[model samples]
Target chain A: MKRLPVNRLSSRTSSAIIWIVLLTLPLWMRAVGSYTELGTQVVVLALAAMALNFLLGFTGTLSFGHAAYFGLGAYGAAMTIKYLVPSTPLAILVGMAAGTIAAMIIGALIVKLRGVYFAMVTIAFGQVFYFITFRWNTVTGGDDGLSGWHRIPLNLGFTTIDIEHDGKAFYYFVLLCFALSVGVMAFLLRSPFGRTLLAIRENERRARFLGIPIERHLWLSFVISCLFASVAGALYALLNNFTDPRALYWGQSGNFVIMAVLGGMRSFWGPLIGAAIFVVLQDYVSSHTENWMSFVGLFFVLVVLFFPRGVLGIIRRRTMR
Target chain B: MTQLILFNVFNGLIVGAFYALMALGLSLILNLSGVINFAHGGFLAIGGYLAYALIPFVGFWGALLIAPFLTAFLGLIVERLLIRRVYGRDPLYSLLLTFGLAYIFEDSTRFIWGAQSVPFQVPDWLMQPLSSDYFFLTGYRLFMVLLVGAAVAGLFLILTRSRLGIRIRAGTLDLETVSVLGVNVRILRTLNFGLGIYLAGLAGVLAAGMLGLSPTIGTSLIMPSFVAIIVGGLGSLPGTLLGGLLIGVASGITTVFAPSATEAIIYVMMGLVLLIRPRGLLGEEGRVQ
Candidate 1:
């Protein structure tokens, strides 16, 4: 009881520190021998992992196929820019809508399932999108990926932010989007819906007996989670200026899940830290060796065996002790 | 046109047989231990590659006999070393562990065998078409079908008649009760994992012969197997087998009409199954949870 105030204070301090670091990342990135693009990637992937944690950590549902929505968002943004309209904001909205709509349908179909079965069905469904992107060569560029499009600069009527040409400006642009998404997520999590989700996660049967509509809540959570994931995916497309079927593959879903797990699924900001570590580690290792898969795999094994609670989890445990 | 459809249906059956083989193994491990063995495909690849390596020394016949056992032995070691620790934890940890193992397996195979597709040889006699009317009906295809049938039959026989098999089935239903009844649940799970991996291995070897042997040979087949499980029913092995065959035939038929949608067809079937029968064709009532 005595530790509660101090705990709250420390958490407040930590979040502030995290924000400071993120705000200063571009300035210090080169000094630390990393580039701005890499920092942008970390934020993008962190959003994805956090989105996944929305369902996995809070709702107690494990979705192993989130990459489908991520990929959908990426393709939606890319195609909107390349084929439909060249407006960046419109592309992001279209991408988000595409992913959310797909999630609505898919979520409805699989909402009744629980645990391992749900994860299995999700993975199987994800492959459908992956196959679509891979085989629809005329539209999607098939295995070559959807290229020849780039993110356009934002026009705020009075001022134009040249995100296309300026890497640092783009990084801040991504960070602003992240901040908005994260703020909304944090707000939603503090609401009654989030509390109900926690209830379901803790004890589904008890929550059901208490008159909560389990399937509806699960479906809504699934959709909301995919909404943010798609947002991240759209940002990811802009960062790269290209999108591929690999973005939607089950393997990518696995990466998102690992990021959530690596950061500490139970905490709000855990996935962000997980994403930063994973993105950096992957970038570094892939650059150094062709056998990077082995290293990544080994890292996963070590994390599962040793650090299953994650970095944030460890810190929390120590503080609690 | 009829011939084309028939050819595809037949082709689909063969592919379905492979899916059933892999899904059955996956289902066994999933049912008993609650671990989705993502590396089941990796095990399949190992089985194929191990057979490929042994073919020179032991000949094709000898490799077929030896390779699955070797793969199963590896499965037992993996279960003992890694998979055993995460037995009763959140399914996420086990899934992640297996997913990692999958990455390592694919990478290791690529490192060892090179990233290029390697030629996996069948006997010249087996390579010949059994009939001119159905050129797809090669001796090797027939042999593969026969062997898969025998393996499936043998698996069922063991499950029904053998002590270990019964224990596995029992463990799948109520592991705690089985454990309390003096069965060493640890050994049961270890052996169960090995049995599952053995099927994966067998499927891998058979697949390498039919498809080009690449590091990703197992990876490509895995999603279909998952579909087979969902379509067939989660808790039922026979259902998984049927699901596998159904999807295979469905895709094969689809190929004649829409070649681009062949891969997507099984998923469509899965969606339909989930809508019509959420528990799958053979899935048990309470096993879904």
Candidate 2:
């Protein structure tokens, strides 16, 4: 149900168009008066929204505190590079591990709950990390945020890629990660385990009747979703060479949820499209006015009222006709 | 040391009262409407700012009495226009709607009032310490406690005794039957949302007197109220009230020993309550899953 494999022909064609636009984005972005970094940012945030959709769209879990893990990923990566090692890849691993581990613990606590109660508990749990980061200023740099740490170059034993100095190389690097992450997610969504998740989403009572071990599957989905989000978080820290407590705040979580929803949470590529629009709009808005937040808020209200089905969802409906 | 502890305990109680007040309002909307009301803090800010604006024209006492009603009026309109459309839909839309509303409220407040903290004056007599020995006892603090107590009592009485209150309680339990029984469910929900916003507005004015008026003031209190609701028990008003006070006291007690853990301790309490009673202390049994 994630997609109509029945519509495989059309999906393949559209996916081809998607890849073509993304792969050559760096080349044409200048013509559009945008930089490669913005492209990379869209890719990175798209990855995050997609990860959130893994749980939210597929499993029907409404988690509202994913930013905690994302922030954990960011802080973990930043800390590793600043204090222990300057290796970029290792830092990403450490960040992912930190976030995923925490998710495992917290996911267990929330798996039994359904719907809004689950959402509320996740939100409450998220603040624990936020408070820790905000209060542990000595180690975390507190409110000033973690800075002075930079993304290091990648040495593949054959050649050294200067990620720090070359913007194009870094953009390619992030795009590569995005491709790999989405590929894995797509593959999983097509698998048997994935169908089980779909079952739970469609009808939890029926899924339980089939002995799908509902809570266990949910925990796995939660952990997987978080792992992907944390990876995006690491990339985000690399993108900026800075991490702040704001990364873990619940507001950031809301942004991710909106991205997924606005993109068409039911579709695989919906979040990516949503992320692109959101990132570009946000970049444009913040630069133009101090009241950018209100504008963004207005966007949300309008979307909820008018475009709740999202761009992809509407497109699908039109195509079906 | 005794004086210091006592002062903090009392201080915690005041803070707890604020949490209880806000949480009670939030709970009302959540139970009946199924909207998380993320913009709640935004409405709270509106209430505080409304009072601030009114104080210049009407004086503090008048603003205190009038601001919440004004805020609730705004809330009723918002519910009628915006929130009503999303009723019977997924909770996600309402949450996102309110989240956006929160952003508007915070930014608008900052834009209008200037982002800096604004002084909201109380009367001189209320500011005076009652006695040298119990110097922390100010008339204003006492007044806040008494007003909150009355409000809480009034709320409980309205639910149990009044016709509208009983209707609201019945609606919360089952909306279909209530609607089938000839109760206008639409008006009921609108009124209920107003009641919730009214509580938020009242909390705002009281909070402004102690914390001063700031765009972020409502946000700062919103989480504690959330924690209070969870720790007390979901769908239970008295539980929310107790949760607020309990967490307030817990944080207050923590401040005496490990000052930094005050905020963290509340979450810790939430975790403990979850572990021991997954649905919360006073949460109804069926609500657990």
Candidate 3:
């Protein structure tokens, strides 16, 4: 405590602050004119954005098709509850498995590609899932979206958590999942494998020369990223109790990417902050006007032009100076 | 059945032509500037709407001639203002910028055009069937094919024969070397982007006649163009053309046996192409890899 490094100290304090804020979000949310659902939405999307940043930020790979996995997870959970079983935990697992399997197959196919080609292929591949869901009207409900399903209440052996009807309880459930995913990600990032990913991201050719199996690592990273994204997706389905093809569209993938960029791809908690801002802004603007797309688009432009390093990136830069 | 198959094949070819036109422009920009230009579809919508707006003031022929030029001008302005700023940055920034531009364009078009499908007019003479036996062959369809053919031929000529074309090719291969050789790489990229947008504009004007004219016309057609590029091979213009036609014909034939799979079939083709030959049917091995 007498001589703690400023960076390390600040980081610890910041993370502590973030946790306290998130933990007490439901308490203060209404006082600030927000609700529990919006807080939950922020947590869900933040998890997604962080998952995306795991690939885009840590691995230095651009994937523009992540919505495919997200949607797959959503549909998996929705369909499980509707057709297979009504267990909430089972639906989440099934959703996660569905997305992971898809990612495994697709990642294998596109891992060899780099740069824009990789991005392009991922986007195109994502559309396959979108079209399948869109055209399979009988099963997927097509353009109308999958409905008539609700998130089942968690039935723990010791006690039951009625997250189904209680908005605050659901927020806590989503928050618990978010914390677990984020903890795992953070642990992974601090490990040697994560260091290797950073090495690859920094200098792929150099890392390749050092005998790092670049493609295999990239594929694994991609799968892991999508796995967590699908977890977020499953929770998203539970949040709304509905899922649609729009969840898997490339445009949604783009939103995930923008969130990562906006939060600062270089930092761990950046996407969480970014997601909060994005979700809140979207809720406010869409409520105010029908031309929200233009505003959102203009925000993207402004961010690209002026805040390319993102909010946290700027803050970090200023502090470093 | 034979007549139906023939009709679908012909219809597919025409659709393929549109894909080729759009893909070629996208390829030109990508090759020269290394930007994917996700806003390419947005430009196509602008071209369609611009043509639709001009038809009453200028005749259909006049609108057809002027609309593309107007769209190209807008493309040039966009390039100069926004796109050029991100040229030297990471490819991610450019992609995000274009994605934003795409959103803006789609939303702005909806705002201006009222979001409903507009009735696009073509000359009555052009809409008439050429013959009762081949009743599917309307004069407008034939004219679209001829005009597209002329445009393709003209583009190839310019690429191969003109100094600007040679510079563009050289630039695509290595812009640094081209820049050192006294060519203005900045102007080259600008013109290349404009050229690409012109093709999109042309496709948009032609498409409005055949399909419903709406803001989403660009969005629906844009994906196939991407498929065309992938099937054709990256960095290969002629390959894009062949890929477009191949998928078009493939999907067209599929319509005869399975109408439901019309849209899905192209994606299947793309998947197969990726599996069999990741480098694409005609893509250079060293290009995308």
Candidate 4:
């Protein structure tokens, strides 16, 4: 009957508290009926942002063109359902696979460059992808994007759930997927591979000298990040029921960078918070003013100048103190 | 076919001049401040809009002369207030900060100018076309090419022979070491930034005549300018010129031949160059490697 160590107990209790709180809130919000779609949007974006955090926070790599992977996932999922299979699970798998392949190819060449050159090369590659989508009018439907896409259908042999018919149900489906992805990411981060990534980010030359395969780690991180982004993209397409070429645009890629920075780059949960704040602010401000772009710009400037380490960083410092 | 090629060449030369002016400014600022100055495009946009505003009062030539100076003054203020704080920090921080500034500048321009395309008229004197039996070129375009050539030559002389230019170059090569030797490094950095902005403004003015003044013009031009810099090798003046003309010619010719793949052509060129020489065509070995 000896008392468990305080640190272990505190950690276990905190995780229990977090899960209990998260589990109840969705149910409580569902009772209120207003949080369904908003909750789903948050979940999807948070998932995407978390994927981005893997690269930005853990690996110290800033990608200016991650939307290419996101768009690839969305397009891949949609195309699979349209052409080969209408099964939701298969489509998602196809989307993730496509994203992984694309990332492996691009990341191999790009990971060699460092700093701003790396960022610009990614941007350039994104533009190349954008141009391909725009030019391949028959496949992608060009700039207009492909619509009339079907939703992911759940077929459990005996029961079927059409996701598009119920927003709350679809929200739950996405939330569940997000939870799985987050769990996977958390596990990966806690693994030895994740420790190696952190080590490489801290001192790449030192890591290389210590017998770490630096390039392989970077490529793996890039591919894994891309896979997560693609999953988010696939879910986003399923939620929206449409896919457009704009998804692959450089501006879209820039948005991910903005989101990553807006959330504290130093913390795991920062990008999720960043995405939530960004999406909410954009929706609110654009509704009120035609000059939303200017307002967003002003906000961005203030964020860079005053809160350089971002909101989470500020919070962490204060909490630590 | 010959006429089309000639037209594209002429167009490329004129566009290349604007590219050179913009890239020259960017290179100078990069050398002096060790920052990419992503807001360089915003300064160009301001010059175009300012020229657009001044077109009615002082006419195009007068506006051309005055607008860039005004934009340079704005650049000076930006450097003093925002850029100076993050001078010795990580390069990524500066890049992100300038990117944010670029967004602010771009959106502010849209808010002020109402997001519509502003018509920029070439002066009546220079509106005529230079024609031969086989090919024709616009008089204004030809003028722009000559003007940019003279400006390049003037800049070269100033940097190589003039006392101020020598100090600026000395400051660029080794900022702290030169500062310890009693040179005013901060002032030189400010001047370099101002000159860079001035060149951007000049490009904007020229662009107003060719592409017409618009808020979206900066967004469109920024990528091409970046492509020129990357292809020519960063921080090299001559490289900027070579990169700009190469891109301009390639883009123009590609548009003429394969309209659908025009946007793709720049990236294809960048990829080919990166494959062969990752540091760029004229980039110093191990400079950006």
The alpha-carbon root-mean-square deviation between model 1 and the true structure, to one decimal in Å, is: 0.8
Query: Which regions of candidate 2 are displaced past 4 Å?
Result: A1-6
- What stretches of model 3 exceed 4 Å from their correct place? A1-5
Better of 1 and 2 by lDDT: 1
**Span of 10 residues, lowest total lDDT, candidate 1 chain A:** A2-11
Better of 1 and 4 by TM-score: 1
Write candidate 4's Cα lDDT for B101-203 as tens digits.
7777888888888788978977986867767653456678878888888878888898899977888888777778889989877788888888889889989
Ranking by DockQ: 1, 2, 3, 4
lDDT by residue for model 3 (B29-76), tens: 988888988899999999999999999999899999999999999999
Pairs of residues clashing in candidate 3 = none
Clashing pairs in 4: none
Alpha carbon lDDT of residue B172, candidate 4?
71
Candidate 4 chain B has its poorest 10 consecutive residues by lDDT at B129-138
- The C-alpha lDDT values of all candidates are 0.95, 0.92, 0.93, 0.80
Q: Kindly list the per-residue Cα lDDT of model 2 for residues B4-52, writing each as its tens digit.
A: 8999899899999999999999999999888888888989999999999
| Candidate 2 chain B, run of 10 with poorest lDDT | B280-289
Sort candidate 3 into its docking category. medium
For model 2, residues A152-255, the per-residue Cα lDDT tens digits are 99999999999998988998898888898899999999999999999999999999999999999999999999999999999999999999999999988989
Candidates by lDDT, descending order: 1, 3, 2, 4
* Top of the candidates by lDDT: 1
- lDDT at residue A241 of model 2 (Cα atoms): 96
lDDT of 1 by residue, A1-321 (tens): 988899889989989999999999999999999999999999999999999999999999999999999999999999999999989989999999999999999999999999999999999999999999999999999999999999999999999999998999999999999999999989888999999999999999999999999999999999999999999999999999999999999889999999999999999999999999999999999999999999989998999999999999999998788
Work out the TM-score per prediction. 0.99, 0.98, 0.98, 0.92
